[model samples]
Target chain A: MPKSVTLKDVAAKVGVTSAAASMALSGHERISEKTRAAVKQAAEDLGYVPSSAGRALRSQRADAVALVVPNSSAHVFGHLYFMHVLTGMSTAANAHDAQVIVSTNADTSNGGVAYERVMRSRTADGAIVTSAAIDDHHVEGLVASGLPVVLIGNYPHLADAVSVGIDDVAATEQLVEHLVTEHGRRRLLHVSGTLDHQTGIDRRDGFLRAAEMHGLTDVAVIEGDLAEESGAAAVEQVLRERTGDERFPFDGIVFANDDMAVGGLAVLRRAGVSVPGDVAVVGFDDFGFARVTTPGITTIRVPAEEMGRIATERLFDLVDQRPGGRAHTELGVEVVLRGSCGCDPERAAAPGPTHSH
Target chain B: MPKSVTLKDVAAKVGVTSAAASMALSGHERISEKTRAAVKQAAEDLGYVPSSAGRALRSQRADAVALVVPNSSAHVFGHLYFMHVLTGMSTAANAHDAQVIVSTNADTSNGGVAYERVMRSRTADGAIVTSAAIDDHHVEGLVASGLPVVLIGNYPHLADAVSVGIDDVAATEQLVEHLVTEHGRRRLLHVSGTLDHQTGIDRRDGFLRAAEMHGLTDVAVIEGDLAEESGAAAVEQVLRERTGDERFPFDGIVFANDDMAVGGLAVLRRAGVSVPGDVAVVGFDDFGFARVTTPGITTIRVPAEEMGRIATERLFDLVDQRPGGRAHTELGVEVVLRGSCGCDPERAAAPGPTHSH
Candidate 1:
């Protein structure tokens, strides 16, 4: 096997100091273009790979970021919700010329171990955290360590931390209002994720606020794990228990996330319950499958990918020590009216041709 | 801001040689336990964060692997199937205490540029490649460069290259056989990815072989991009052009991948056609949302996560020059029988519980 080349080889080949070669290859502005080209060419010819650490030693930048999903490894892989979040984070991180280091634990209690390792080892210059709960200890730990951190979801207690997220309350309120006033959806059921999560809490709170404002008192709430099975089981429980006609039980169902919504949709369809014509439904996070399902879901487009991009850019700015930066950033959400919500009457009459994107 | 601590600082504080401190901290067998404890305590006191690249240099290991999806960056983010593959790969990579650097281009043609950059710079010690076509130039380049490379899918031309993938032919045959024997379906339609890809070619060949074996002559084929919309539109074209009494009209559809299958399912449902009863369907890749849809798709489950794990480990072995290793590895596939194929007659009879994995 051929021996690996080193920076000294590139420098000797280019007739320059090793430090000069390193600086030139790293795109330092102090180096002339001719010298940079010569060094790069020599390095390429010799297959002299510059180590990220060597570059960091000179530039004081790791050029890599960490994306922390505060969930167990099992949960991360099993849940579709995390997949969407990961897609957004990875795409954005790659766009910024940075790689993402995912941190997860084997056990739920060891969630902080991954972060501690990243921190004490300085494995990443900055971190983008998703699904941050209020008063999150991990967020606090990251802040205390002085690492640049950005949150993808809201954490009310971390008022001084940079965060990027959608307005969960307003988004859910708009969804509920549309179903109640526009679609005449009485007897509403709000299928929520674990209330421990800020997103679930805020969304459920918004739904209740909208319900109270509209004088719709017959609201039933069910808690789920923000997974498809949870949504299906929650709805099943509601169906098996509901008793009187006067209760006007659940003419509409709203899920906190798309995975749950898809699950709920399947359960409703399986129960021979007509969607929209009977119980209209809406879901959060306009995930890819939302359009592919039958009677396509009415969902709030959370701009998850966009939020990820902006959050990463902000974290980069922090890592670079930019001044006058604010602590939080919020992206907008739009309600995508689809067949399930009954807001699109024409959809029921003449459904659009199903196509893949 | 606090200045980052270095190994030299730890050594100085601990009154040890830099080499002794390094060996001690790294847990080298040559170092005494007492010395190792002293070195470790100094490191913690001084906050000496070990650089991954520096460690890689001393150990002659990159401690990182690359999962090269040869498609463009735009294509990766725009498609959900890639997201699933990435999730699986990420989970596996993380479990092995390694980081995965995902690299893609803006166009498939530009795949070589990104790969060449990584290779010439040695950003990763080894790479697991997916999205390589049968005659992909990128694979050829990597082979010539003598890097540790693993192909996620089979490439018959590169018989020496290590690969971890399912038997596309056998999996496709099983899907066709299930539809024929179980559902009593006669007319079979195969929706495939680009013919240039081995997966598409193998799956198409398998479907044809099954049809021939079953004495069915009416086999129709549609070429799609393996996207949801493409699958839907492809089927829509077939449905629109078919004559009312055309002999052996397609009643069963086999898609090359799950995204396309989901799209085909939506298109069929939108056309007022009942799935399984009117047209049984099967998709490949058995991704997360496949089970959540009504009449959940019957598909082949590719062991994507396991494939990724084996691919990474094999690449590590190759880079590290482990002996007695072969060039290619092929994994297995399982047929996930679900509602879409009409295998579960009970599912069609009533709304069943949502499926979870």
Candidate 2:
């Protein structure tokens, strides 16, 4: 291997003292922007690769962050939407000159196996945990470990924990309102994710709240473990139990996420049920698949990438010991109109064609 | 924090010596399967948390692996198919009681910034690098770093490096044969991913070889950076450069991946072109979105998760210093027929609905 470049080399090239160079490289406000740029350029030109050991020793930081998702099911990890979050986190970490490491199934249910290893090894400076559940022992363990951590998605029980995400309850309420007022749908069936997840509980609560507010007496709920197969199975169960005038009891079905919605749509199609005409359907997380679906799925657009960025930014703040900024950062969500909700399906179905770079 | 359960505790619970417990936990052949199971059960029951520091000191291994992808564009990271690969790797790692850490942009083009940190910090026992380009300095640096690394996707130039993946050439040939023999597509336009990538080169070669075998003279190729936007833009360019009697020019178009294929399909729709009626379209990587597209894209189904599992298994083999197992492990691919490629539009368009937990 070539001789590793040093900070002194960068300082000499920039015609500045090592202290000045260090300040500039570190983005310390004491150094002028021009000096900082020059130092960074010089460092780049010199191929100044900082030794991880020396940097860790000097700053007592790993210069890396972990993005942990407590998913035991390999299928959940395959959710394309989380890829957007990963991209956002990676972008933010790259901007800060830090690395991002992703770990899945690092939950307390598994004895916090991955988390314990990461913390004990000091593999990362801080971590951003996503989709935290209510009364999650993993998050509690992370909190108790004295590691800088930030949670994405709301958890009222984790009120003291730093989090950055949207209000799932409000988003679902808005969706339900749209379904009720605009579409004139009274009998609704909610296909929910696992209650263990805070998202499922919050969305279900919002659905009930909206139903009560609209004075809708006929309402039903079905359990889906946030999987497409479960959604299809739920449809099968609903179909098997139908009687009288209403073959399908519900006029509208709201799914917890787009993945399950796709499955439900498929089941409906196989049964020769026209979307919106027979059963108006809506889903959360407007994934790429939503646009391509027949009639397009009306869904809630969560700012997944933005949430990831903000959560990472919060974790970095805690890692840097920045005070007063560790509170929950709640962003807003939008209800995307599409054909599945009896909207102008053509134009609304137009996918903005997501691009990543 | 509660005191971490030690080997002694597990040993006592299993009615064995601490040394025996350690040997069983470490998978020593001296221990019987029953003893190993008992020891593991005891450890789990006691919630034994292994100290990474102690494990590292004893085994000179991190008990973790890094799955790194060279993603310059933020969009590339969002390629939904990667989730399968990640799921596979994570599942395999979980089975081995090891951890999987995902990292991106660990390229030498960025002065090997991420790679240097990962290496210097010794964050993982080994790494599995995916979709490596032909002249990737980052991968070269990784190989030279003397780190036990496995490359996914082929790199003919890196003759000395260990790799595990499928035969991209054969897969592409199968796609082309299906297109020509079954669909009767003569004029073919291949929208290849960046030629700098081994996949692109190999696939392009297959297309040419298959066309030659069919005695076809009209064949063209276009460069795409594997992003959906690029595929859409390429469609626009082709339309702009079309001649008389052929507004679109090509009878069939094959995209490198599903993302680009989705983009191409959108452009085709905007142009009022009938898929398979005006021009047949096929894509690589049969992502879930492929089924939902209006015409349902015919695609090459690469066993992504299996590839991930095999590659990771290879990396672990090297990490364990096992000999005669560093061979290139190639899996098979299948062509999934759907509507876009001039097949049964109705039945093929039916999405069987993907499931995620």
Evaluated on chain B only, candidate 2 has a TM-score of 0.83
Q: Give each model's whole-structure lDDT.
A: 0.74, 0.77
**Per-residue accuracy of model 1 over B235-304 as CA lDDT, tens digit each:** 8889779898652258899998888888877667667666776778889887665675667788898877
Model 1 - which docking category?
acceptable
Shift in Å, residue B277, candidate 2: 3.9
Model 1 segments more than 4 A misplaced: A14-49, A72-74, A78-96, A106-112, A244-248, A346-357, B12-18, B27-35, B45-47, B72-74, B78-95, B106-112, B244-248, B351-357
* Per-residue accuracy of model 2 over A124-233 as CA lDDT, tens digit each: 77788876666667677777766788888887776788888888888888888999999999999889998988889888998989999999888988978888888888
Predicted complexes: DockQ each = 0.33, 0.22
Best by lDDT: 2
